[model samples]
Target: MVDVMHQEVVALENRRRLYTGLAVVLLIAVVMSGYHEASQLNSGGFLQGLAKFFDYPAQIVAQSWEDGWAFWALFPKFLPALIETLNIAAVATIIGALIATVLSLLSSRNLEVPAAMIPVVRRIMDVMRAFPELIIALFLIFVLGASPVPAAIAVAFHTSGALGKLFSEVNENIDVKPLEGLKATGSTWLQRVRFGVLPQVLPNYSSYFLLRFEINVRASAILGFVGAGGIGSELSRAIGWGAGNEIAALFLLLFLSIVAIDQLSSYLRRHFVGAESFG
Candidate 1:
């Protein structure tokens, strides 16, 4: 009986290995095929362009070094644009979190939402998340005539859907005792959630909101590339005019700004999540 069981285990192990090997091979083949197709569709082939990929960056860096003063000079010129990008991100995050808070409660199974409406609301969030922020920004830019307004709207729309899904999951893990206690006191649904659910999930919600703000900051800058009015638009124009020095300067500023925001957000998230875990 022991011999028979040992052989069966070996066979199962062999079959698992066989399946894993096949999956890996299939994944590699798919990746290669996708790369080949992308290269063919691209204006420049991958291998051909790969060699020159660093040429632009190299040139920009050398030019920046040669004219370091000019690089510093561009900061004052672009300060307002950077501020605009930050403002866009802040406003969008606030708006998105506000909307998401409501949607999350409605979508959460633990809440008292109508069963039939849950799927409908979830689908709406899915639609919002499905569309890329860039696509939304461009569409809004066409309608709104190219301003930070469109960028903010695009980021907010996506953020609400994304955060709503996360917030619902957080709601699922919350203690039901508070909710029941509130209900026994004749509290309305909204009152129960506000007094019970909000306290439990606020830290998690805040952590997500800060993360989204970091992402929206980057998105806002990218949206500016499409003429949404921010540093990105200026960077696009500078590149278009072949202003290598200015491009380098803008790149430096962008890099620094992103790093600063990333560090600050990371610190806040750690604190918030840590506090929630302790509580």
Candidate 2:
């Protein structure tokens, strides 16, 4: 009994040590990834390539606002624009979800494929996901002429790559029984996917779409800085002129909108997940 107890204690210690090592490695990986992204986003070469409207700190501080209360006055004006920003987010997410769903079945690991072409397709998806959405917006603004259309296209592409990847992962993890049953009944590959895959993943798909919409809401609000229309344009304009109150109101509205979204997304997620019942 004494020997068994000692061995159990040793095994527990080893498991704890292994978990600690894994946690440390994961933390390091996350930090490195964030640093790499920041470096890429701020690269001078990238800025030059995009020809983004530039801001100079010196020019900004040259303007004046003496009263703190003046900043608070600007929020009310941003309300309508904020709603427009949320609409852009919703519109982008809906369009992107449809585009991505089609791509996802093509990308799913479990899907029957022409063995040689899967990698080619996946690489295309990877390229789309690798660059930031803002970069896509920049290009769209260039080609599409800086309207909300460009902004929506940018969000759609970003969401497609991301949500497709997630959907593919979900596809891979689903129980094989339903899929096998379909195949057993002489179902074509497409039919197998239609019946087997869609049911299991719809909850997760909706959840991801909602999350993307939340991000897009924030993204749309700022797309205007690059001439892609949204409330972000006005907010950026106010900030440029040292209209601190307007900026504050815009930011506060953003905070409230995001908070509301966070709650709504949580409720929807739980409802879909069956953790909470929806009436």
In terms of lDDT, the best-performing candidate is 1
In order, candidate lDDTs are 0.91, 0.78
TM-score of each: 0.87, 0.72
lDDT of 1 by residue, 36-124 (tens): 99988999898998999999999888888898576798898889999999999999999999999888999988888899989998999
The local lDDT score (0 to 100) that residue 226 gets in candidate 2 is 84
lDDT of 2 by residue, 219-255 (tens): 8877878887668898788878876555656667788
lDDT of 1: 0.91
Clashing pairs in 1: none
Please tell me which predicted candidate would have the highest TM-score against the true structure.
Answer: 1
- What is residue 134's positional error in candidate 2, in angstroms? 1.8
